[model samples]
Target: MPNSTKRGRRILAAGARTIGRGIVRTVTRSDAGAHWARVGGDWYETLGELKGAAMKLGQLASQYHDVLPPELSKQLARLQADAAPLPWERIREVLDGQWSAHQWQLIAEIEHAPLASASIGQVHVATLRDGRKVAVKVRYPGVAAAMDADINNLGRMLRMAGILPFDGDSLKAVLEEVRERMAEEMDYQREREHL
Candidate 1:
């Protein structure tokens, strides 16, 4: 993979505040289940679009059935399977940089649409020259370089929004864990070796 051309993320305070207000409203409403469902959907959509630390944390948090409201967790679980995919154009040019001419020749075809998408990458179905099907995982253009910025900005935004219910130091500790996990994820070589 070549160095990324994309820039780091910056969370807007106003946006975070808006999301926070919605959450507060949901919690206070009589129709708590309905409101939680809506909040979860909104969260899944928003975090999926962000495609970085935000989405990663959303996915992680969605799994806590005991911790989060059931309605919210149900919607949030979609992040693991159905998060929005990046367009093929967003990653196609970088394919050349990822492989040599001869290596590229071994690929018979690669589908434009992703099979699945997550915080750091998307998976595409591909065919090799030998006619075997394979899955290709493509990292987003800037996700590796932007991980730290994404984490910091997300932590600040979530805190300001009152989403995480943590003090600064506690949130800092959690974000640090996310950073370490994402850092490991960014190293495809290490992942491949483990596989």
Candidate 2:
């Protein structure tokens, strides 16, 4: 019923489809690894598209190169790359909530498309009234609130796949650290002070 649940279900369905397709394909002796690679690739692609905690989990999984096979780590590492961007209309709503009419007047132009997208946010190019260009990072709506659920869903999915390299305690610790970092990243004032 929750948004994260919906996303998790969608990811599971996609995985099921990938496995089904792979099973239907004639498996040669040497193609077994290729089959797993395709499935892993699909899993990482879904995680990348989901972003949020899902992408974070992929990033963490990628770090277990010492424990996992090199090929698996290499495939999962791709999840660390940029994710798909949010639409301009959604970004506009976020800006509307953050800025009043008087504050908005200070920005002369904001590009509809984002310059880059990360797990939790995206950056856009904006021109100030005085013609100074700046990068504005916008957080995805409700991502902070949904962080825990996303992590839980991703962990469950990975465990179910029998591909989790870390033990439960280690996974918990890593996820806690990630949550803290995500919170810090969302704090624009903190970042400004640091800068």
In the order shown, what is each candidate's alpha-carbon RMSD? 4.0, 3.3
TM-scores, all candidates, are: 0.77, 0.82
Residue 35 error, candidate 1, Å: 4.7
lDDT of 2 by residue, 1-195 (tens): 137767868666655655474556555344656665776687677777777767777787788878865666788888778577889998899889988999899999999999998878899999999999999989887677777777776656554555656677877787778787777877877887898
Tell me the whole-model lDDT of each prediction, alpha carbons only.
Answer: 0.73, 0.75
Question: Best candidate per TM-score, number?
Answer: 2
Model 2 score (lDDT)? 0.75
